[model samples]
Target: MSRVLALLVALAAPWTPLLRAAAARPEHAPCAALALSPAPAPTGRPALQDAPICKKCQSTGRLPCAAHPRSDCLLEDEVLFCSVVADCTACAGAAWVPCTDCDNAPARARIEEKKASVATRRVALEYIDQTMKRPIRKAESKHFVLVWEMDRLKVDKKWLESHELLHLYLKRLEALYDDYCARMQITDKEFAEKFRVFVWQFPQDHHDAGLRFCRQSAKGGVKLMGQTPSYSVCGNKQNFQDDERLHRNIVHSVTHLILSAQRPVAWIGNIKAGWLDEGLAHFFEDRYWDVCDTYCYQEANTNVDFKGGRFRLAVRRMVEEGKFPPTAEVFQQNVDTLTLPMHATAFSYVEFLLNRDAERFNQLVKKLKAKVATRDALREIYGWSVFDFEAQWKSWVLSTYPTK
Candidate 1:
């Protein structure tokens, strides 16, 4: 019985204080009344010292505190206190949140799009490699690419991929040639020999290489590729969709390319005189008008303006009258003074020369090649001085194509 009584008493002792406190405190007792001391005195200065120390700093004993530092605590009655202390994990004003899974569906889509673009670029590169039989190096700097676009190349939807690829291939080929020349100290003749040999090894390779060289050297590095290789058609597809225009455009462009290759100095880097340059291209290709009609030229009148047409006719009349300029002057005339009228005059002159004396015309071209700028070459070939040739040519043109 004594042992049982002692066990019960030990158990009761543990709970006695809680029961006594509950009974002693009334439910309605005021918290302010229960507080032991009166409110603290106010200090005029900012309650900096009264602020609570950071819990992290207090536990870790590090200065400047971590979470809920002394600098961050707010004071009410000259006593500092923190809204939250134990759970705080960062310095004052810091933001913290639980880790979240980044939703990257949009980002993934963009990455995939970029990959597709890269793949397209690679396809273009491969096409150039197979076509030109040359390894191409891409210009890594964006600046070079931009300059290439402005000064050397342009691309559109019709031939964006194809044209840019060609430009890159050409750049690579030039670089390779320069490198070879530097290493082997080869003369122009030797370089040409090696180049021709490489190109001739395969028949298709030869054709492609020839065309590429012609296209690059001609047109002053302007490359335009379309489904039909017809500029008129390309323009139509881009604007009016007129098929006849397409055919004319093709003839003109192809002629330009061929003549430019044959007479490189006349076209390349001769931007100031594009009129004569263009006239020569037109004159040479005019022979292929029948082919042009077959594609798309009959529906549209592909004639130059009246003034230009008159000029062309006058030039033709001059050739008819045997009063043409020296071959050198003909090639080297400044385009600005040789306006549309002058172009027409020149074209007509060239046409008459070709039609009436094809052999003489051919000989003149050969002579021009030997002495591109010699007055003596002109006098020997045509029996006329430069000034006399000009005056007589003008007189003949005035008689033939009178200004209206």
Candidate 2:
């Protein structure tokens, strides 16, 4: 077999007899899938996209033994942190193995590298008063800073504060963040820490000022509903005078920002597949119904009022017309190449996977983020062969999707 084929075979069936023998041997007591070798600190900024994946650990930045030079372990709180599955008799202390699904390399090297460079290239903040004739003011909570043009809003500070609606909106955003962390099964401390959000709200008179602040054009692609730049974590909003539009846009854009700033596809030097990427973003867009705190429920087409239902309906039409791509093809789609139908299909596919088993879906997210091959990761994580996944996913879609 060719080297690539051999690797695929290994990935397809990781527990082969040879690997079993190696694991059983006393010298290689804990069978490690990948080998690790540490080198000196990289000179200058090493290519973020060029970090090599160890065949043993699959670029997870983990290893079978703390003795391995690349075994990313630390002596924290008198515990011997290691990624090995088996106990390390050498260190009688506790071991801190990464969740088999988690990928630490991006956190360890990629984010730290980019953060250092990003911190140096700061853009000056533009105050609204100097640019626009309207009365605009800024208010901030722990994670978000909002600058709004007073004339454009139906609800003012007095009304918002009195109704506690302003607090509720900010709290809603916070709840979204909490929901995200809970789904990923990690804490805020465990993720990349740069999460401060700045929102620029431009009512009618202040919309021009918002554009000027962001240095954006006033027409064409300048609808500028909301944006989260790849270079920074903040989002800019324009013309979202309605409460629902504002809420939906904030949830959507902020989801992208959090994913970018946290597990960070940039750190991996690759973009995620469109289906999971956009689907997760859309999924968060409807995580809460009308309120953030009280009685939240699962988001689905038959049940939820979120826009994802529209996407699911679009996907259903494609399915009936025989235009929807196969599961394998969808899995391979890049965001740049995805069509509108593809987006709909991708979102539904993610929802399908999530509904089947959310924990497994989350594992698939981690594995994919680590740049594991899609088919290999699916087999390893979900234990579903390609044939099984396609058949089941299609069946689930036709049955559960709304026809109306």
Candidate 3:
């Protein structure tokens, strides 16, 4: 026979003889066959005395040891000898040893498991790159890397993209503010010095999980939402995706950032009152909403009923009545709760005050900023009580836009 055929035949030989030997000399008979070494070992390492003759080796062997890296001892009678060197450079210095019955299956299984895990990780990373608008950089709080899950961000691709873009927009807005201040001859050294922005995207749990969207740290570090307002984006299912809604959400959230950035020294003292802080946010964001309305006119569709028509009437009435509320009261009675005849009332009221009389309104805001006390500040700015301001606003509404 040819050399290759002869070798094949030798390897294909039955293990019956080896099995008989095992039965006859159970104590010393090999349990597994030896495979041939691919290359000769260096001088130092011990070489196999001869090809192993275990039943498994004889039945399945080609040359050195097919099971050299691993073998099994069957009962106490059968000794499966593995003949491969543990640290042969020819074998890439890999250790070869008999597989223990206990760990053989698990070891092989672990290899497969690791392979799958690597594949999953690759997929998740690709999804993140394709879905996320910007690269998510690692954030540190003390020593921990804020490691979070992918599912927490319940917002979809568009929503997440828009949300993160808002963060980028804030940086742009800061630049814009710096430019505006410089051109207007305002010394913004103090204004620019007050706030530092920190963008966090936490893993979310569910669709509507509560993630901390935006918060001002005690030390004045601002955390802006990259997903929901209060929840982390690690474990949530993403769903938010209406373009208009997304824009509104971004504008609203960034407006908070801007106001927080420009927070006056006096307002900083009473920052705990939810009404005052949130109301101011509302006031600023409401104005921003108008600006967005004009800028993105095609996208401007009223999602909430702000009683705009009724508010216009109320403002007209208040103007005719020559009465307006102190800035403090407007800050006190949350703008959202204050009633109006039309849907856009609050928005219209803010628009009229800020757009028509920005100077006077800014003056009132400054005065309120100094006073801090809602009632006292209101009295000082508008010279009207809270109730009187409402009446005048309503009368103004009636006078400006008559229902009949």
Give all TM-scores, in the order shown.
0.33, 0.49, 0.36
What tens digits encode model 2's per-residue C-alpha lDDT throughout 1-404? 33543564478474354443333343533324322322222444332334444555665553333642232233221111111211334332122333244466544453344233222321111233455553333323344434432233334333342113433455666678788777666566645443333344323333353356444433211212123321111122233435565566567655655665554333211344656766666666545542221001121112323334466666667777877777677677665465555656666766788777767876777777777766787899878887787777778889987787
Error of 2 at 237 (Å): 10
Cα error, candidate 2, residue 306 (Å): 14
- lDDT against the true structure, each candidate: 0.36, 0.48, 0.35
The top-ranked prediction according to TM-score is 2
> Taking the tens digit of each residue's C-alpha lDDT, what string does model 3 give over 269-363?
13322233333334444443432221111122333333342334444555456553443334444323332222133444444445445455555
Q: Model 1, 1-404: lDDT tens per residue?
A: 23433344456676443333323444523233223332332433212223343454332223322343343322111111111221234422121211123323443344344334434544533543565556432221111111111111233323333224323433443453443233223334421111111112223433344365334221112222211111111132332234333333534544443333332222321433333345544464344342212211122333334323334444555556665444444456543345444455446555545544555654554454444443454577777786765665455556655344
How far does residue 160 in candidate 2 sit from its true spot (Å)? 4.6
**Better model by lDDT, 1 or 3?**
1
Ranking according to TM-score, highest score first: 2, 3, 1
**Residue 213 in candidate 1 has what lDDT?**
37
- What value does the lDDT take at residue 53 in candidate 2? 45
